[model samples]
Target: MELTDNDRSIATFTMLAHAVVHWFELAIPIFLVVWLDAFEVSVAVVGVVVALGYVPFGLGALPAGLLADRYGPKRLVVLCLAGTSVSFVTLAVATSIYAVAASLLCWGILASIYHPAGLALISTGVEDRGTVFAWHGIAGNVGIALGPFATATLLLVLEWRLVAVALAVPGLLATLYGLRLQFDPTAGLEGDSESDTNADGDTGSRAGSAFVSNSRTLFASSFLLVFAVVTFVGLYYRGVLTYLPELLGGLPAMEGIEPPAGLEELSLGDYVYVGLLVAGMAGQYAAGKLTSRVAVARGLVAVFVGLAILAVAFVPVSAMGLAAIVLYCVVLGFSLFAIEPFYQEAVAVYTPPESRGLSYGYTYLGMFGLGSLSIAFGGVLLDRATVGVFFGTLSILALIGAGLSVRLLTGPSPTDTEVPEPTAADD
Candidate 1:
């Protein structure tokens, strides 16, 4: 199937906006310690704050998706991006920890909109959805990689508030530009339609009733399982990445650094540490490509298993160990993103198109809500133990997640049927 001019344009805007919003969304986590140092907060407090931002991602994600269904994915995305931008700018003006905490809540809510709406849009825009989703993952990674460098540079030259405001502006502009994008409403362009059946079809009365009933049934079971998996995924993802800097800082290799003037002060190793994130980007993109060639569940199992092994490998701590950690990180990127396609595809299979946003919202809620706890737990663990111990714990969690992912292989049930055709009625 050929992409219409409109499809290409919407897809381009969607991917670019996704990247920018994600960049700002993820930037804070990588540099949480900087905020704590700059504001005189503790690591535990920072963990709480970091986790709070993610809470809305879980709570607001489904609502955002439902709203997208009611209105349009494109419009919800615009709103989410703009809202996130404004919320982040609030961080610029924060004078106390409470203020920052509040800002994070707002940011989480806004950041939550991307997955369901954006993924649905991409699913609608392209026939080869794996490719679209792959690009989506790549876009997010681009944002993720940019976060550390952007935050680090800004901290060097300006206050964090100024940096946040700068970050907010781009999202605001993207939101406005998105407002003007034209799209096919029935074709998953508008929010409430259940099927892509043509306007001329007289079988609506029969199909609509059955579709609604089936959707409700499918949604219940799928929601529980999806929620469990996504929550675990989010928790693991945010937990690991949020603690990455701290983890690296505490490594035996890093113990050699001369005591710096302040924790906020950059270390020579910080630059090298940033490069590890770059490897994550490479890993994610590579995994995205590989998904089309293999089963996503199998790929996830491989990545997590490797991570578990490597996490344990780091216990010995040597040059080989460091290389193993880097290898683990690279594979982590691949595994993390590889899992997403399966998730998205499952949503497509299990959820009614009308409630797709809701499906995403619930899944994101698990990811963000439960995941936030994981982040805090990571911090607590770090406060109490060594990097090897913390990562080793994460590796075990990864193994558990791998086992749970096996459920995906059973495949989407019949109630999860997606519309086979894209038509004007889809709008």
Candidate 2:
């Protein structure tokens, strides 16, 4: 693969956009504690509220993907970011749990477009897909780390409403800048620039047939297997991350947790939560590179098994004192996201270039859609059962994902047709 101006531009734009997507997505967890107190709701009820937003974040991807295929990624991406910013502004003014739910609903619907639009843009547009995916994952991890850090930091000074408004700022600016970026969405396809759907002039009455046909094409192959893996990944992801910050904040940690002389709201647990996400940058980069070198299923199997162990071990490890907790956080954080690049690569391998957007649609539908239920499930657990039960459940999920990944070992080796090699420029 060769690099071009378009690759650089698209890669840069999508990477930044990916980070912003996660910036908002992950920060919501940080707000959970505050919402629980402010709204005076039970954990189970709050979980349902958050899920209302999250479910659509996944479910909307089907239509968003179709729209991406119909219009183009850039326009939908613009709407996603811009609309999310507006939704967050609404959140800032929210007076009740109902208002917050409405705000999240808007955010979910708008932010939902990103995975399909952005991932499809990169898969079909960037020549060196793996390299860009590495960068993309790294950027998203940064957002995951920073969004919470920013939220926590701001909460120390401003009210939660103000923090919401402040966090919305960068996304709006990113939308403005991304709106001006120009790149060829099909530059990575080399000579085969036109997609089959576009070539056939798919529209209106044919949309239903296109969806059924596209979905069939995906499920007919190993894409179904890839989808299953991602679904499990989503389950673990939402289950753990949704409450991690608040969970960590409650941990009895060492000297680092105490606020400095002037700072009031700072704590070591916040650092631990953020650090775990920061560690994921390394995992994401490594796994993204690994995709070019190894079979994705084998890697996913190893990663999922590791996650199961970590899930079972997390509560015990935190008991050993602050250092052990931090170490656990680092490893847990790294393991949390390591599966992403591989599964992303898997999706690309099992699917075609033409339905790329729809493939990612199903991809996120499994991830965000069904995965949102775990929030409620976890909430119920936290409300009724011990933390031990919660971790044990997470362990089961990881093992199931591992079991699914084991089947992919029978697939053929990589080729130019499967995982695309990283370009020299990427290195």
Best by lDDT: 2
Model 2 stretches with alpha carbons more than 4 Å out:
1-3, 26-52, 90-101, 151-165, 191-194, 197-206, 246-257, 262-267, 380-386, 412-427
Clashes of 2: 1
Q: What lDDT score is found at residue 302 in candidate 2?
A: 94
Query: Once all C-alphas are superposed, what RMSD does model 2 give against the true structure?
Result: 6.1
Clashes of each: 13, 1
Q: How many clashes would you count in candidate 1?
A: 13
Q: Per-residue alpha-carbon lDDT of model 2 for 216-276, expressed as tens digits?
A: 6567677778889999999999999887777887777644456667656666676677788
Question: Against the true structure, what is each candidate's TM-score?
Answer: 0.76, 0.83
Model 1 alpha-carbon drift over 4 Å, by segment: 1-7, 27-52, 89-104, 155-162, 185-216, 219-223, 255-264, 317-324, 379-389, 411-427
> Could you give candidate 1's per-residue lDDT for residues 1-427 as a string of tens digits?
3456655676677777878877886788755876878789899999899878866676777567655655656667777888888898888778888889898988887788887777766655445455556667777778777765677677778877788887777788888777776665334334433554232112231234443443355455644555566666776777766766665665666555564565556553464455655665556556656656766556656766665665565556434445555555555555555566656655654555655555666666677666778777787787898666777787777778667666655656435544323323332
> Model 1 residue 351 lDDT?
58
lDDT of 1: 0.65
